[model samples]
Target: MVFDASARRRLAPYRMYPYLLMTVEVPSRGITDQWRRTGLARLLAEEIALAT
Candidate 1:
């Protein structure tokens, strides 16, 4: 999704939550580099879907 300034402001607080939560807390932290991005994207999609 294309985000504007408003979206950035809305998400600024929890920006690290998703990345660190899924990576640091979960053992799946094994995912690194390119694949790491894919994992984070899936996490974001799940969040958006749940929010909707």
Candidate 2:
């Protein structure tokens, strides 16, 4: 779900308790640098799924 620009509380803290095993793909350094420029250092669950 794409959100509007004025959505309230767009950013929040993420905590993983007793973490489960999963295949995690780490983005490349170049991608991370680009995100930092755009203030997108992290992503929501839905956004991550969409990205994959």
Pairs of colliding residues, candidate 1: none
TM-score for each model: 0.39, 0.18
Model 1 ranges off by over 4 Å: 1-17, 20-32
Model 1 lDDT tens row, 4-32: 76776577547647665666644465655
lDDT for 8 in candidate 2 is: 26
TM-score of 2: 0.18
**Residue-by-residue lDDT tens digits, candidate 2, 1-52:** 8645433234222221111111122243234445343333233444444333
RMSD of each: 8.2, 11.2
**lDDT (C-alpha) at residue 36 in model 2:** 40
- Candidate 2 to native Cα RMSD, angstroms: 11.2
Point out where model 2 deviates above 4 Å: 1-43
Q: Cα lDDT for residue 47, model 2?
A: 43
